[model samples]
Structure formats: structure tokens, C-alpha cells
Target: MMTFRDKTVVFNAPKVMGILNVTPDSFSDGGQFNKLDDALKQTEKMIASGATFIDIGGESTRPGATPVTLEEELDRVIPVIDAITERFDTIVSIDTSKSEVMLEAANHGASLINDVRALSQPGALETASRLAQEHNIPTCIMHMQGTPETMQDLPRYNSVVDEVIEFFRAQIERLTANGFEYKQIMLDPGFGFGKTLDHNYEILKRFDEFTQFDLPVLAGMSRKSMIGNLLNKGITERLAGDICVNTVASLAGASILRVHDVGEAADVSKIIEKLNQINV
Candidate 1:
């Protein structure tokens, strides 16, 4: 169980985290929820669809994506976060790597800090450490081979699974050394962040390996290029593939499913829950 603010998410069953990208170029569903009204509507839809967490990202981390300024990222996400906290009762995750952005979003009512850069940015670790100490806020540290701008430029790994596990092992040690408790940290293998088609599949096939830390593992393969590239499907046509991969992740012990289609992902969780309850 992970407690944030006044809420506790019991991971006895897998939970769904809806992706709400408040950016103009997030590769998929970018501009759809950048506006205040649209973001609220989508939040309502996702909550009603059974999303336990709504992940709001200001900057686009797509391959070859350009970086947004601190001011622009803050401006894009803070207002939406404020409105969502005021209106909804769901946990809000701030998907950013900026220190100032993490502080502002937490002040405005974000409970989870989902940093793809794994809080490696200059001041991000310090800021997040403070937040964790004060609010007991949890952070999800993902494994990315390189920066978003150049991660896909011929990505390579000596042993993807071992490297990711080592990365988590090192990161958890660093975060705990910096004052974060074991329960306050989560892990994401970072599908499609810096991996090729083969690398992504290898991680998926070995998804259960990440559970070694006993921390919650988040599988965020929703509408990612891994699915698109593998199945020869376009962005909008990858839902079936997304569901399949997420199902595999769930059975492999993923505690959280970060996805674009909340309703479908929720359904997947339900079926998996039922399966887990069956007698062998």
C-alpha cells in the first residue's frame, strides 16, 4: 500500500493510471487536453472510467522531441493540476524532470512525482527529497538509457534487463540515501524511452524480474512506439496491442498500469484480478 496525502492506494490488485499530457507534442493525445476545460473533462471521463491516478505531463518526452522551457512547462501544468485537485478526489502525478516544476505541482496538490529522468536533473532529487520528507509523496523513477532528444539514436544495452535492474538497484540506494523510504519509491522499466523493438520485448518477457525490489512496478506501454512499431499499427490503432502488452505486464506482477485508455485498462485489471483469484 502506498499512502499519499489523505489517500492510500492498496496494490492488492493492479491499478490504472490515466495519462493526461498537457503538452502539444506528446506523440499521442498531446493537444487533446492541453486546455483547462478539456483537461477537466478528460479527467472526469478517466475518473469515471475508474482511473485511480491521473498523470499530467507538461513537457513532451517523445523521441526527437524538443525541450520546453521551465516557465512554459510550469505554465502548462500548474493550472490544470490546481483545477484537478480542487475538483477531483483522485491522485495526481506530475510527470516532469524539473525541480521547480516538481515543487510547484506538489504545492498545487500533486501526490506522485513520475520522473522519466529518474530525478537525475540538477535540483530534481533535492526538491523531491524535500517533498517526500514533508508530504510522504512517492516518486516513480524510470530507467531511460539517454535523454529524450537522443535516446533513440541507436540505443544499445549490454544486457537490457540486468542493466535496468542495476539501474533500479543503484537509484533506490541513492534515493534512500537521500532520505526516501523504500515504500516511497516506485519503478518503471521505461518502455520505448530509449529502447529498440527487440529491447522493449525482452523487458516485457522478463517483466517479472523487476519485482525483486518489492516496490510497485509501473507498466506504461500505452500507445507507445514499441507497440506501434511491433504490430505495424499507427498511434490510434495500437489499443489492442497496448492491452495485450499491459495484460502480460499485469500477470508478470505490475502493480500499476499507466495508460491512455483508462476504461480498457481498468477492464484489463478486472479480468486479471478475477484470474488471480481463481483456484489452481
Candidate 2:
């Protein structure tokens, strides 16, 4: 077990986290994994494709996505997690905002909480802190300016980089003050969440600056509008751009890549890792 600076264990070294969204509203693979067999197959494929972690999300957080009830969300994700964790060696991370779901999922063997809201939800940090303290699961503190429904509509940032940095700083301070383990924490500068194309690239370019906090950075620009807007392609056509974004994020010191296409991201990361080795 890797130790955080006197906090939660690091669980494992930085690795690619595959996205497994089993909802009808996900922008990329909605309705594809609503069935048990399909969900299992996708999980198996991601495992075989070199995913060290599987992030199972039930709700679609894509821009303007409608919300699902906790029961509905649980109905989609838990069984899939139950299926995958039994068959795979990968660490399971639950992507949720509800405190009840987090607690239940954590008890059901989730090792991480990949929260988009960064525990700002009511009782979120407290719930996460309890889980972390008792369960020893690492949590990710991600930055998002607004909710998905309105995030993409006329999003603005005075200085994207500074704003993100400040968000992380404040969240980390809060987590630390609450006696949560800092080492069990990671940070993400939300790429397409409320960011313009230029803002997205700037975050990607300056991603290394986030290392100043001495925690891992998770970059998740998979099939997002950032790529589509830049290349004028649809979601399916964003694979190449996604690979490129993965490469750039790796180069800029991203420790993990959250993606839809696990194999492609694995390939890109391998090549980037090789280049990094040569340079080093």
C-alpha cells in the first residue's frame, strides 16, 4: 500500500482509469451497457486494454444532462461493480455525488470516490471523510465551475488556470482542515466542464503546474466538446483527438487519464512514456 502524507494509502501507482457509463443519457456510450452482459463485456475489455482502475458512472454528466434519482443511479452501477470487482484485479472507483450512494458503494468495495463536485455537495466532504478515515479509500477532488445542465452555456473564466488552481487549493485546505488524509487525495482540472476550447488547452498546457501540490492529476477530456470544438468532429470522430489529449496531458505531468476508449489511451500513454524515458 502506498502511503499518503500521513493520510489515506495511495492504493496503487498512477494508472489509466477506464470510463464505464451505464446510463441512457451518456453522450458516448449511453444505453450500450444497460444490460448486464454488455456491462460485463465492457469492463472486461477495459481490463484487458490496460485499465488499472475502472470508474463506473451511472448518471450522464454530459452537458445539459438530466438528473437521475439515487435509486435509479444505484440500479445502473452497483450490479456492474459487483460483477466487475469479482472478476478483475482493477481498483474500483465510483463516480457519484450523492452521499448515500457513496457510503453504500464504498461499503460494497469501491476503493475511490471520483467526485465531479469535489465533495462540495451537502454532507459530501463529511461523508467522504468518514469513508476515507474508516475505509482508507483515496478520493479525487475535481474542479467544476457549474453543474452540467448549464455549464456549457456561455461558460466564462477570467483566468482559467488561476481559477482552477485556486479551486484545488481551497478544496485541499478544507479536506486537510477536516482531518482528511491529504495523501489519499487527487485533483482534476475539469477540462470540458464549463471551459472554452482555449481554456481547455490552457489547462492541458499548464497541467504540470498542478504538481506543485504533490498529488496526482487526473485528466478526463475523453470525447468531450473540447475535442469536437477544436476538430469540428462528432463524438465518434474525437478518438484521435482524445488520444492526442492523453499524450499532451501525460507530457504535462498528468498521472492518470480517464477515458472512454481504454485501449487507445493505453497505446498513447505507452508511446508517451517511451518518449519520456528517452528524454530522461
Candidate 3:
């Protein structure tokens, strides 16, 4: 069970983390929920559909995307987070790499920190450690080869899975060194962050290798390029492919599936749990 604030999330099946991107340039669903009302409505729908967590992101971390200022990011996410917390009984995961945003979101009631950069940005580690201890929340540290802008340009890996595990090891050590318990950290292999089509699939095929750390594994393959470029399907049309990936990841021991569609992901979780129950 993962405890955050007053909420304790115990996942019998893979928990579906509904994606609520309040940005103008995310690869999928960008500019769709930038409004507070729309964001709340979406949050309501996802929670009603059985989302255990709501991942709210203010900045667009899409490859080649321009960066937003700290003020701009805060302006985009704080109000929506406040509204969601006021109205819903869901855990909000702040998807950011900025230390100030992390501190402010924690203050405003965010329950988890999900950073693509793994809290390596300037003061992020310090802030994250303090917040984890103060709020008693867990964090998701994702592995990326480089910055979003240049990550896809010339992505290479001696062994993608091994390198990612090593990255998680170093990150976990750093977080523990800064006073965070090992249980307070999770791992995300970052499907499309800096991987080619083959590299992404290789990681997915070897997803269980990460389970050796005994930490919850998060898979965020919803509508990523690995599916699109392989199947030639656009972002909105990748739901079928996304569901397939979610299923495989869950079967591979992913504890959390961060996805764009909560309803379908919930269905997948239920079915996978049922299938896993048979002791034949």
C-alpha cells in the first residue's frame, strides 16, 4: 500500500492514473482541458470511471516542445489541482521537474510527484526529499536519455533495459541519500522519452526486469510514438493499441498504468486481475 497524506492506495490490480494534461502542446489531448471547468469535469469522469490516481501536468514535455516558465506552469496547474482536490477524493500526482512547482503543488494537496527527469533538475532533489518527508507521499522517477528537446534526435542505448535499471538504482540511492525511504520511490521506464521504436519495445518486453528493485513500476505508454510509428495510427486513434500495451505491461508486473483513457484502462485492469486469479 502507498500512503499519501490521508489516502492510502492499495492496488489489488494495476492502478489507472488518469492523465490530465493542462498544456497547449502535449502530443495528445493538448489544449483540451486547460480550462478549470473542463479539467474538473474530466477529473470527475475519470474518477467515476475508477481511476485510482489523477496525474496533472502543467507543462508540455513532448519532444521538441518549448518550455513554459515557472509562473506559466503554476498558473496552468494550481487552480485545476485546487478545484480537483476540493471536489474529488482522488490522489493527484504532480507531473513536473521544477522544484518550486513541486513545493507549491504539495502545499495545495498533490499526493504524488511524477517527474520525467527523475528530480535531477537543479534543486528538485532537495525539494522532493523535503516534501516526501513532510507530506508522506511517494514519487515516480522516470528514466530519460536526455532533455525532451534533444532526446529523440540521436537516442542510443547499449542496453536500454539495463541502462534504465541502473538509472533507477542511482536515482533511488540519491533519493535515499537525501532522506527518502526506498518505498517512497517508484520507477517509470519512459516509453518514448528518448527511445526509438525498437528500444521502446525491448524495454516493454523486458519490463519485468525492473521488478527486481521491489518498487512499484509505472508504465505510461498511452498513445506514445512507439505505437503510432509502428501501426501508423495517429494519437487519437491509438486507443486499441494503448489498451493492448496496458494489458501486457500489467501482466509484466506494472503496478500503475498512467493512461489517457481511464474507462478502458479500468476495464483492462479488471480483466487482468481476473485472469491473474486463476491458480490452475
Worst 10 residues of 1 by lDDT: 4-13
lDDT of 1 by residue, 195-277 (tens): 99999999999999999999999999999888898789999999999899999999999999999999999999999989988
- Candidate 1 Cα deviation (angstroms), residue 182: 0.9
Cα-based TM-score, every candidate: 0.99, 0.93, 0.98
Cα lDDT tens digits, model 2, 122-164, are 8888898988788777789888878988888887988999999
Please state the error at residue 225 of candidate 1 in Å.
Answer: 1.4
TM-score of 1: 0.99
- Model 2: runs farther than 4 Å from truth? 1-14
Where does candidate 1 clash, by residue pair?
none
Model 2: pairs clashing at backbone N, Cα or C within 3 Å: none
Instruction: Please tell me which model should have the higher lDDT, number 1 or number 3.
Output: 1
Candidates' lDDT values, in order? Answer: 0.95, 0.84, 0.92
Q: What's the C-alpha lDDT at position 110 in model 2?
A: 85
Q: What's the residue-level lDDT of 277 in candidate 3?
A: 85
Query: lDDT tens string, model 3, 112-171?
Result: 999999998899999999988887877899999889889999899899999999999998
